[model samples]
Target: MPRRHDPERRQRIIDAAIRVVARAGIAGLSHRSVAAEADVPLGSTTYHFTTLDDLMVAALRQANEGFARVVAAHPALSDPESDLPGELARVLGAWLGGDRTGVELEYELYLAALRRPALRPVAAEWAEGVGALLAARTDPVTARALVAVLDGICLQVLLTDTPYDEAYAREVLTRLLPAPGTRDGRGPGSLPPPTAG
Candidate 1:
């Protein structure tokens, strides 16, 4: 028998790995399982990914794109005149508003980094990517803080299975943002200073 040309085999395997993780979580992800899910030869998975960690790294990288795509779709996030906190809260709402299966899948692969050393760098990429986008609106410190707060908010919502409150999220995010005219004298995305009541 001759070999068949399947250009999308690698991507198919990655997609299958994501589905497997979504259904059975990281514990259920294996080359055999991915092969069956992808419907490619078992050898194909092994050939593409030498180890489970390799496959996981690919899946995590792909999963991390879910939120990034949402963020990218909102150009206002990069604008200085936009309401940073409100925009971020709105973005979070949009991400969380859709079917949660993708969100769960992304977080599962992200959390797997705790036990899988190979996945740590890939997991960090998600934070780094978001931070870079936020850097345009604020200082590096604030950008990093925003990432942390966003992560915490997402975790809380997912863990508690509570409805996402955009208003609460915007208020919480507002506290982390620098007051107007604070960042390098470039007043972009600055919320008014809080009143002392």
Candidate 2:
């Protein structure tokens, strides 16, 4: 009899590990812990990953993939400078927030990296890739600053219980935006069509 490939099962365990980390913190993770979450045999965890190091790396990749998706889905609006408070608010509202998605899981992996040195590179890549993504969206001089604040906002909101006001986020984001009609890395202003009269 042919044995069915449990590649899907292995992925299922990795996803479960991320959620477990999100809920219980990575400190609580173990073969048993993840296996319990996935309702799989302990041997399966060993079968898929020979060492805890392997498992942690796999989990980090999973987290990075998810973060990439969120970033691609919600990019900041172009020309934040020209947009008034209303348009600014709309853009921030649609942006990737701290806790709304699973920022917690990613942060937890960050902590885990302190214990697992191999995971650090993967985690660092996540930060750099996301930073570059935002920076590329804005003027060269301000791009890094813009990315930093947006990332900071997510970190702040995650640590709190209070509601995050979209309007307020925009205000903060507005200050972070480049001056209106300023040129990018490319030369002079590249203006868009005029809005309705």
Best by TM-score: 1
lDDT of 2 by residue, 1-197 (tens): 34357658988889888877878877788898899898888888888888877888888888878756654554443344434333434444454344554666776676578788999998778767656655545554565665566566666666774545665555565566566433332222332332311
lDDT of 2: 0.65
Question: Where in model 2 is the C-alpha error above 4 Å?
Answer: 1-5, 75-101, 139-141, 178-197
Candidates in order, TM-scores: namely: 0.87, 0.68
Q: Give a tens-digit lDDT track for model 1, residues 63-148.
A: 88877899889998888888788789888888888888888899888988898899999988888888988987888899999999
* Highest-scoring model, lDDT: 1
Go through the candidates in order and give each one's C-alpha lDDT: 0.85, 0.65
Give candidate 1 regions above 4 Å deviation: 1-3, 180-197
The stretch of ten residues in a row with the least summed lDDT in candidate 2 is: 188-197
**Given candidate 2, what's the lDDT at residue 11?**
88
- Per-model C-alpha RMSD: 4.9, 6.9
